[model samples]
Target: MRCQPPLKSMVYNWLNNNHACLLCDEPAEQPYPLCVACEAELPWLDDGCQTCALPLPMQGLTCAECRRRPPAFYRVEAPWHYGFPLDALISRFKYNSQWPLGNLLAQLLGRWLNHRYNEDLPRPTLLLPVPLSRRRLRQRGYNQAAMLARWLSGHTGIACNEQVLTRLLDTAAQQGLSARERQRNLHQAFSVTTSAPIEGRHVALIDDVLTTGATAQALASLLLKAGARRVDIYCLARTAKPGSA
Candidate 1:
């Protein structure tokens, strides 16, 4: 038999390859940014609507809203609930140009998606970032969703196309709007670019967060209208309905 390396030498090599946790600055227990403890403590969405990924108390059941009116996207996959440090980190990444935070979040989500694909989740033919209107893009100096999509693409070898969908209207922010108001606000808000090749293809829409999902519905409808065979939503986090657990 060939001579084997010493156990001490193997341990030293393993330690050198470990990543540092972004949150605590300690040696990460996994390949992603956070240590095992930090990751375990994250506000993960353990149970939710199968179609929209809306957070719910019970698993294996659809939410009443989805049962009544389903979203345009056929399915949603998100890793976390919009709460705690995640919300704060996303705010900083979107508003303050803090790209490292966005990178950390993208890595976490990408790892989750990789595992999901292994479990037979359908991988889209194309990945598209939800478009930011010209006005908002100018004001913010960047589109957070695009950044996240690019980062995820790099991680998972998925090709991301940012120019396929265009935000036609610079609708007011959706933060203060109720569900109905949000849907109304996004009416006719998105249009497909003439050059986009959408026919008979499955597409995934990437975004930082999925709130009421009105925006997602509007865009997914446009993609389907443009002849996409199926559409899926991929976001870093999903918010619970008001007063929901």
Candidate 2:
């Protein structure tokens, strides 16, 4: 026989069944917090580079950067272009500890990923979050990437292991850094745990956003060196090239 949810959980769901939209004050649509109108207005990513998911002028074309120096990861998948209210929402969730917003975004991303999986995107065997250093984790009280991985795991039924990757050095922040600078900042910063057997296993790295692909490249290189079969990045948004509208 199937088991029922706890009374507290049921009651909580009941109370939140008709909550207001997070983007606007209108009644939220069922299964997501945003109303239909607001959802339609989001900064959806239409076409991007074949490898890094950077916004591109045409579909099925690789961005110059990728062609010049391909990223370490196989491919990147993101639903939105980092812009406007989406940026604000991600910032609040990541820096301010607003978990509900993060949960809503993760649910939507999971739905998008499911559709992609049906369309022939290879499903990964494990979901791994980019690890945070101990100091940063303590200051933030949580690792947003880890939270995203866990939520994606719950939504997609994929196993998530937060301990597989770790941050060995508390490097300088990557924000505002050029791609080269960002790559340098991440050097020798991450490692895969020895106990986690990633050999021949396809894995997806979860994060809130993908910018410059520097962090993803570093992590993917580490995973590849550690014997992972393949590495793909899954993030909520991907930033376009600087100075592009």
Candidate 3:
């Protein structure tokens, strides 16, 4: 014979197992904290550029920028377009320290990556989060990309290495900058850690969003120069070209 849990313990377990939908505040039905309806309403990235994941009018076409000059990374995989309630959720998680929201998004991304892997996407050997400068890390008390990578590693069973890249210079904020300006701002902003085991390995850089692709381009170029066989980007969302409907 076994003793049953105490009443309080039983109640706590029940509550812990039950989750409310993050978007609708109703009881969640999925494994994560989102309901079926809310999840269906997310701004899914159906068609995009093959190289940079920029939202395009149709499928299987590269954007003009990529055609003009390709990026360092081979490609970018993202689950959603940066819009609407998704943007609001990311903002809260990134700026307001709502970590649970970030974790939820990461879990969804991991599942999406797993599906892609089955559909012929090459699995990366290592995951590296875009690093933050020491000043920004101290100010935010956390790095959201690192958090996403950590959770993604758990979900995908891929190895995450946070120390592989170091932000060498604290650059200006990227908001409101033109693509050219953003690229210039990130110049020399990052470096590969000494003796990082990236050579001959397929590496993936994880981040919350890909806007101008400037940060991803810089990091990918650095990794390639450091002898990485290939580099790709994984982000939760991708922003459309400015003024695109």
In terms of lDDT, the best-performing candidate is: 3
In candidate 3 the C-alpha lDDT for residue 172 amounts to 96
Lowest lDDT 10-mer window, candidate 3? 6-15
lDDT (10s digit) by residue, model 2, range 1-245: 74845533553474477778888889876666788889889999999998999998889999888899887799999999999889999999899767778888888999999999999999998999999999999899789999889889988999999989999999999898998999899999998886356889999999999988889999999999999989999999999999997
Against the true structure, candidate 2 has what lDDT? 0.89
- Pairs in clash, predicted candidate 1: none
Q: Candidate 1 — number of clashing residue pairs? A: 0
TM-score of structure candidate 3: 0.93
Off by over 4 Å in 3: 1-16
Better of 1 and 3 by TM-score: 3
> Which prediction has more favorable TM-score, 1 or 2?
2
In model 2, how large is the Cα lDDT of residue 113? Answer: 96
lDDT of each: 0.87, 0.89, 0.92
Q: What local lDDT does model 3 show for residue 76?
A: 100
* TM-score versus the correct structure, for each prediction: 0.89, 0.93, 0.93
